[model samples]
Target: MISNEMAQRINTQINREMYSAYFYLGLSAQAETMNLKGVAAWFLAKHGEELAHALKMYRYLIDQDARVQLSEVAAPASVDGGVLPMFERTLEHERGVTATINEMVDFALSAKDHATNIFLQWFVTEQIEEEATVKDIIGRVRLFGDQGQSLLMIDNELAALAKQIGQGAATAA
Candidate 1:
């Protein structure tokens, strides 16, 4: 069983994960507005992944026999800043997630909650990969996002990426 404090923190994280989904959804809309179909699809995939992330935590809480209460998710900030800024925002958001996970790890260790700590280790590794992936995307955006033809090429690449993701999912099933 999980402590009330731990339960509350997990609930908060779930809500934040919901917000992350919305953030990516909003970015998808922004990408669509910019006529970047590939980018929009990429963000939509990210949105779905965030939903899965929240669900993972929700299931963990339920498995722990803890109450799962959801709070309101605040609106994501405006995405009017464009695609490059969206990636920048994504990196920043990921950095914050990494910190929160670190805190949870510390808390788990302090409380001797080995199960929670084990569960959270997945997030620790996930965050590192997340941050690195976003950084790579940001670097690519910086390199190609400024040039029209180049940006279009990048968009095409992203479209292929989305297709590959779909294929991978299909094969896994």
Candidate 2:
């Protein structure tokens, strides 16, 4: 069973995850306006992933018989500049998420909540993958230059990746 404090913290994380989904949705809309369909699709896929993360936490809280207090999710600011900037923002957001997850892990450990700690290990690993993936994408954008045929090629690759991610999410679901 989770302590009230831990449950509250997890509830906070659920809200943050919900906000991340909104953030990605906003980015996807921005990508669509820029005519980067593949980028938009990628962002949409990420939005789905964020929702899944929230649901996972929700289920965990239920399993632990803790109250899941959900608060309002703030709207994300409009993303602009360009695709690279958008991804930079994504990386920044993801890093923030990683920090929060780390904090939760530390909290769980210090509280001797081994079950919660074990539960959070999944998020710890997920954050590592998320940050690395964003970094790699940023590197690719930098290496390819974000324009013309090169951008199209990159966009195409993103589209393929989105499809793969979508399939994985579907399978997981």
Best by lDDT: 2
Residues 1-173, candidate 1: write the lDDT tens digits: 68888888889899989999899899888889899999888888778777877998999999999999999999998755667888899999999988988998898888888999999998899888879978988899887773589788878877887777556545633
Best by TM-score: 2
- The C-alpha TM-scores of every prediction are 0.92, 0.99
**Quick one: RMSD of model 1?**
1.8
**What TM-score does candidate 1 reach?**
0.92
C-alpha-based local distance difference test score of model 2: 0.95
**Poorest 10 consecutive residues by lDDT, candidate 2:** 78-87
| Per-residue alpha-carbon lDDT of candidate 2 for residues 113-163, written as tens digits (9 for 90 to 100) | 999999999999999999998999999999998999989998999999899
Candidate 2 ranges beyond 4 A from true positions: none
RMSD (CA, angstroms), candidate 2: 0.6
TM-score, prediction 2: 0.99
